[model samples]
Target chain A: MTAQALALPRAPRVDVRSVAFWVMIAASAYGLWTLKQNSVPTMLAFPPSAALNVAVLLSCLAVGVWLARRVMRPVQAPPWNGTWLALMWGGLAACGIAILMNTRLLSVWSQSLGLEAASDWSAALTAPLNEEVAKLAGVVLLAAVSTRLVRSAADGLAYGALVGFGFQITENFTYGLNGIVMAGGVEPFTATFQTLWIRIVLTGIGSHWAMSAVAGAGIGYLVSASGRSAARRVWVAIGCLLLAMGMHFLFDSPFLGGLAGTLAKPLINFVVVMAVYFVVRRAFRARWTAVSAEEAAAGTLTEDEERSLSRRRSRRLHLRAFPAGPEREAQARVQRLQLALVEERVPALAPAEAVQPWRDAVAEARAAR
Target chain B: MDDFKGNAVHGARRVWVPLVVAGVLLALTAVEGLLAKALPASEPVPAGTVIEFGSTGQVSAQVGEGWTLDRTASDLHSGLLLTRGDVSVRLTSVEFSAGKPDNAQEMWDGMERLLGVARHSGTEVWLGEPTEFDTKWITGGLYGSLQVDTAIGTAFVLPADDDAEAVEAQVLGPFDADQADWTAATEIIDSVAFDEDDDTGETA
Candidate 1:
């Protein structure tokens, strides 16, 4: 075979998976464009407040990148997978369900505890305990279905972070729309944007993701440990879940009277989250190194296979690193779908079927660019 | 292992960057506060300059070789007018007086007696309404009635002989306690012909 034939094709086959991926990208792009159009006038008038919002957004993006790097280590299965899609969509759905459940449960709990009539602190106390547990349930479900997917605490955290990000985006849109209606003009829109930036971006403190990752890591450990029973893993998961709930509770508590009080909680939460993140990162690095050494010793993966995998991964990363213009965005949409199919490990679908939707997405993305 | 350690260091650096930026912003705010103190204080309106008026009639006259009056109306039935250096004022629902008199209380009592009579019977008198009504008539802008008791009724009217003259007349009514008050009544008149001297003096 020629070198070109031997090499894996750069283009992805179009399919249902590609269609779904393209649709999501298109929806997200449209949503962002609409948001920008709505916000530009207000932001221009209130530059300082707008600057504050942008600062917060940039900070959140930085934190997100950091979380992705720290938690998405170890090449258990490639980063692109059907499970990722499911996790993103399922986690977002779970957050909605959780919020609903938490509201109902908290209402009852508060009434029972005579906290129904209380303001601020009482509500905060109830919310962190109830909502954090509910939001972490998706992470637990993921861990249960695919223990190998979460190789370390970092992996758990990464998965949780993605889920939390999805939830936050949805919640922000809700608040933004409500603000537009309530304020009925530019002033309200600016205020709403600031509020959204602070609540979602500043105080994120890895609440949903950190808590869920703790739970995910514990479950992963239980499943992977040769000596551990399934029952032990369940208990470990439960314990981690409870710990996360406590952290969330303390983070949300209103012990402080003013801005000082508000800053204190997020600061403390950040410290705790950082500590957990570092510990998990260390464990992931060690475990991956050990696994690589053993595999080399056993010769399960030859030097050639390892080199091939490395080259493949690098090519994928290179594709992502390309400048994000119209043509590049289209290519990315196609490539991501192909990767998703490969992750699914389904050989039945024709390559053309897999590649077609991606082509369409690329075309649309190109137009947008 | 070296690469791993380098990555970890990079991660630590990321955490400190935001903190440094925050510190810089705080320092800038402090500098702004210090600069604000160098600005000058604003001046207040000078004394004797009429910045505002109170709820009582006040007539300020600038009299040199000639006389000019700046009168302000206040309250119901209270107003001030001046002509030829003579200032007349009516107090709220009660008093009336003339001249740039210093004792307002004494002047008010004398005016009150005339007004009391005007109120009891149907007498021609100029009455001030709420602030929304026109004040030009009370400010010597137009002919109006200034009535005392039934025995002494003063009517402000244009003279039949001279269209330019604004004159007041005291008419005797049948309900007078004393008929002599009518003959003794003082009528203040102003004629537009007074402007001839002002015009001739300006030309000279």
Candidate 2:
């Protein structure tokens, strides 16, 4: 079995009885219906173009999600159900909340500052505060939905990226519809393509996903049982949120206009996220190594196996030593159990006594081999 | 489950954390709602009043006294919208900000594109010959008549000082509008002027 099998020590099943589950369901229903009502007439008027826009946006979303789920997480993806929940929160709940909040906030700015100042400065003022907080709320709610869903900064990063992707796709769809009206409804299909090209192809890389990923990592740090002090976690979480907001402000602000500036802003955000990712990954690897060493000293892992177990490639190479059949299968099973035990033991999450069951299972599997 | 005990919020009270966050969001939205309600929705402008609009108050127009400003829809940044009887006037400086559709014809075409966006469809739009659109305060602008559906009204793309900005105005009314009301609307248009001295703002 793959390390994915080892990633299931925490419950993956949804608890329908939980308050979070029902809340998510209600929010999604209200948000999706409200959004549909707003967009239905336009969609009906231009069915073919609307369908094309949805198809293209959905395809982009699928690709983004596949990348995050398959390649982004450290050891394994978050549970499949949890991944869906993150998307739902971003697309439905967050966007739906933002429509109302942004409208009110914009009207306030327009009325107070006058439309003159509001037109130029309102978006830069409103979206960073309203949109970012709204999306981040979903990340927090997802954690509440499953306490085990986010145990490390890496977990937060994955969930956050998925959520952002969802928001981005839905936003693209809305923009695609508006593009028709903007182009005067004369060339509806052409207008839809133009909007998609700008929203999806041009600015998609460093948009909602990048911002939410940064904030979600903060949530992970806050909720994680990693040995950081409470104050540090709180500070880091706040720092990430502010940083995300700043990035959003830059994107919406009037400072950087034109094609080159458009390209540069997203690039700036992409680089920042990559840097944050490397830092989080480095910390996670350090914890992983410490647990591997601890298990090795207890003689649960042979010295050779301990060295090879941490890397998927090395594990595959080590498995070659066993003959094909039950022996190789048993060895693979032992490797998976060892990983689960090591993951659970890392940091302050599990004490030695609590980890004994995983260790005993690995031992029995090893003895069978 | 036992291992997760110490890890809840990294130690108890973890489940309540998200709930608290939800409470904060609810509170923020509530405050926003209250703030919006406190804003004045509509305002009345006195007759024969010269209204200075846009960022620097560069564009000035005198009202003939019947139109009530749609305060909720009006913005100092983009001019304003007002109405009197069956006639509605919308003034917007989108051209100055976007830097496109430079002529009266382009502005008229832009209106055609804007109709669907404004939820008006299957309408006929025809424009008249170009003429001078100037007032005592503003000069060097294009003026024309725009026919929408069966209604006809005057359209002006009045230029701002330094010729860097222009405000597009449309006064729409029925094809067979009242003669006295139409004359008053014309006087209102004739009063469109620009303040050449104010340079504090760039666009609406």
Candidate 3:
């Protein structure tokens, strides 16, 4: 069967200019307002240094977004647009809410009960529950806003990681700013720089992003699964959150260090990073399988095409088999057609007609070759 | 369908969209930076004063003379560490989560385990069983003493109050003889106070 024989059906494009999107935007604005109010005193405390630190951090965040997008492109991942949205609307909002909920409210609640605001035990006591819930809320918000975009577990995971990264960067900046003031007007830059290096560079991935991605997978399941029982979905969601909290607790607690000595922290971080990687990798593999199966069933994808879809090495090897120029171009068209075909077949992705021109181009390229 | 091909111009615009959005975010960040710069500096929290921790003024304490607030020892609700003259006294209050054992004995046992006394043999000197004692804020509470070989030396761990599931506060003293001004450390511990009206307390 030739590529021309394959039909390209159309689905209605899901627009992001809806009332719900604006409403979510408004909610984020409100959260930001609250955050500013809560942060004013600290901001004023370390003004000049805080400004410089924030500027540097903002630049770093931009670079981070650019880097993350670059990493995603190789895997034919979703657009960077949604990742930015999750960061701004989801991540920033969650950060504001977390500050209010965890820092202000939870502390009051704990102390009202005559509890020792066990500052040392914060990672286990306060952070896991408040931070996870706040961060996960952003994923939930994105899912609610763009159901079509976040149609699968992988999408949920990617968006969730973006949200977590956003929260982490903003929180890190705030922590650095606070650290400046706490350093009691000492070497502000040195204090702020040390804080940034440790929080931003050292523990960046193993912190919020890893935790939220797992929880977002659970969110992915809840939204994507049509026939699952409500009870089952609730349990899955709870289990994912508990796992996220457990990871956060481990990272925050001194328990592991006590057990493994100095090796405890890095060991825990390694275990967490590996666990999250496997979980997300498995989800992506499952989605890829589903996409391949659909394309194969439709006769749009040959066995060779499906083999390339299975692994990055296979895809690269297939491309390298062709010489440069027209031969390589033709092979590249085949790869593009495969991707377009999957998008067409995958539920709630881009419409088939949108990719029709690419299919025709591939057909022409093959004929020319 | 009119060729179903997106125009080259439209594709180019799509590419520019991310850059435009990023530019706007960067501009907003710059504005925030400007605002931060404009703000007047906050008055520094004075040393040796009764600085309130969190919204719950419930956890309030004065750092000893020449001691500053050790934020590393502080959290969302709790304050820790009053350092002066080679001695540092750490005061921490932790609320137990629901469904956890609340008895004083179990709590002390947990603390012992946390300090690695039960796990690491011969590393710590456990003085004896906890006896009933009273701090300024807490009345009729179980208290015990231990000497950790590590940086965290002599410590007194005890319950904050007599509630069935009360918060636990520990006052860690110095183990080194040179830094062993137990009188000043005890005074710092005694100065620890908790307010009943948490909602009305300062949000610092």
lDDT of 3: 0.57
- Candidate 3 per-residue lDDT, tens place, A30-87, comes to 6688757645555554456568667867887787677555442225555655677778
| Two-way lDDT contest, 2 vs 3, winner | 2
User: Per-residue lDDT tens digits of candidate 1, residues B11-126?
Assistant: 33323432342244235334433432332111221222221111121221111222222221221112212222222222122111112223322222223333333343444444
Residue-wise lDDT of candidate 1 within A293-341, one digit each (tens)?
4333444333433232323465356555567665565545534433432
Cα deviation in Å at residue A270, candidate 2?
A: 1.3
Q: After superposition, how far is residue A18 of candidate 2 from its true place, in Å?
A: 2.4
Minimal lDDT window, size 10, model 1 chain B: B1-10
Q: lDDT of candidate 2 vs native?
A: 0.74
Q: Which candidate is the best by lDDT?
A: 2
Q: Write the per-residue lDDT of candidate 2 for residues A12-93, one digit (tens) a residue.
A: 4455655666667777787798678667667766776789887997798779888888765765566788899889988988
Chain A TM-score values for every predicted structure, listed in order: 0.59, 0.91, 0.77
Worst-scoring 10-residue span by lDDT in model 3 chain A? A106-115
Q: Give the chain B TM-score for each candidate.
A: 0.20, 0.64, 0.57
Please list the residue runs of candidate 1 whose C-alpha ends up more than 4 Å from where it truly belongs after superposition: A1-78, A82-91, A115-117, A144-148, A177-186, A229-232, A299-369, B1-204
Q: Rank the candidates by DockQ, best first.
A: 2, 3, 1
Better of 1 and 2 by lDDT: 2
